[model samples]
Target: MEVSKKKPAAGVPAAKEPAPTLASGKYTFSKSEALRRYLSRKQARSGKRVSKAKRDEQKKKPKFVEKPFNKGTRIVSLKKRPNNYPCKNHSKPRSKVPKKHGATKVRKSLQPGTILILLAGVHRGKRVVLLKALKSGLLLVTGPYKINRVPIRRVHQKFVIATSTRLNIESVKIPDTINDAYFRRIREKRAKKAEGDIFAKKKKTYKVSATRKADQITVDKQLLRAIRPHPDRKILLNYLKSRFGLSTGQYPHTLKF
Candidate 1:
């Protein structure tokens, strides 16, 4: 025997059931009274409602309450006086003046006559000789001006890279005149220009003072004398004259400075 399948009527169509939606737009989930009542009953059954009610009752209680004097009062007395003899705090407060900061620690690699490559500034990449550290915590260095044109000046230790090159300068004594005060630029007070000359254009020129020239000559003389006996004297002078820089294939990290 043969079997056949049945199909829907031609003029009719299938319909989909509508999903439930919330009436209020304030919340995504339903918060109907039935849901509130069910949650309240669940909390009550779980013993949370009792604790919440107790907290609310405690919040409603007065923090301080007055009582009748003789109802439950107890009598007490002090046997001796308390130890607050100096109650006004007569002691002095700590000093407000700040303590002076100690000098900057010199690096172990730095010493008199040690060559240092300056990292930053107008004369950066130039090598200079370490003379001594100033009381103000700055390094006193010089390029001997004759070799690299780097004058005797102060530089922060942080901005310098020490090299392995060192010269024996036991005989080279830095003069006391070359302290921090020596490099300070003294402002010469110019006499007020005559009213007649006020409009005249005058050119201003700066020259190295005789004192500075003399000092540089003195220091360089001693320094050169010490370097003269060294085997690599010419090489040392050339090294100080040349500027330090990295080429295309070179990197600072791999270089053993």
Candidate 2:
């Protein structure tokens, strides 16, 4: 029997292409000691660069848990770490701020002819009458100058003690509450008047400004009607007289323009 050494003819199956090499553009398959060391070093470097990746990922994060906000309630978050006290990791606490002035302050509700007793200053213990709520929430009070000798002026609600007296406004001439600008102008005019005639002069006119007329109007007619006169007028008058050395005049004196 004889064997043929010639290459396999086309009629027979070609030998497998020696298993095509598995190589990327620049690298070939390798398993040398240097290659192993290079891979180990590369992995070690990557691990060092992001050493905290796992620990940080495991660290708890604040979640947007749904919560109901309360007006007077507060909540704080705390973190616990190994070997450190819980308080040590805390952020600086917020400082408490005082309430807004408008919120902290209180204004007394008043109406025309509400009797008030002075609670502070030189007029302490003196009884007066509330004319109206001025533009700045101050009460316009008077002792009717002619009657009780207390002049027309602005007084804070904090400085007066309110009385049960509420006089009828049906005939009371309530002057419109003048603003700061009006008072400023009046002050300037008075100062100028005190100075020489070369200063500014006012064109006096009796016709009232439209704004003044509007302010004079009652804010709520129903409220006004509901304000009944104090039942103990005689008793209150007697008390005022006895306490502050006052006089019960023949008529109720009100502050008017």
The TM-scores of all predictions, comma-separated, are 0.58, 0.35
> Relative to the true structure, how large is the alpha-carbon lDDT of every model?
0.85, 0.57
Q: Worst lDDT window (10 residues) for model 1? A: 73-82
Per residue, candidate 1 scores C-alpha lDDT tens digits across 109-214 of 9898899999999999999999889988899999988899998889999999999999898899888988888878767788766667665867667778998898
Tell me how far the alpha carbon of residue 154 in candidate 1 is from the true structure, in angstroms, after superposition.
1.2
Candidate 1: lDDT of 248? 100
Collision pairs in model 2: none
Clashes of 1: 0
Top of the candidates by lDDT: 1
Off by over 4 Å in 1: 1-95, 188-205
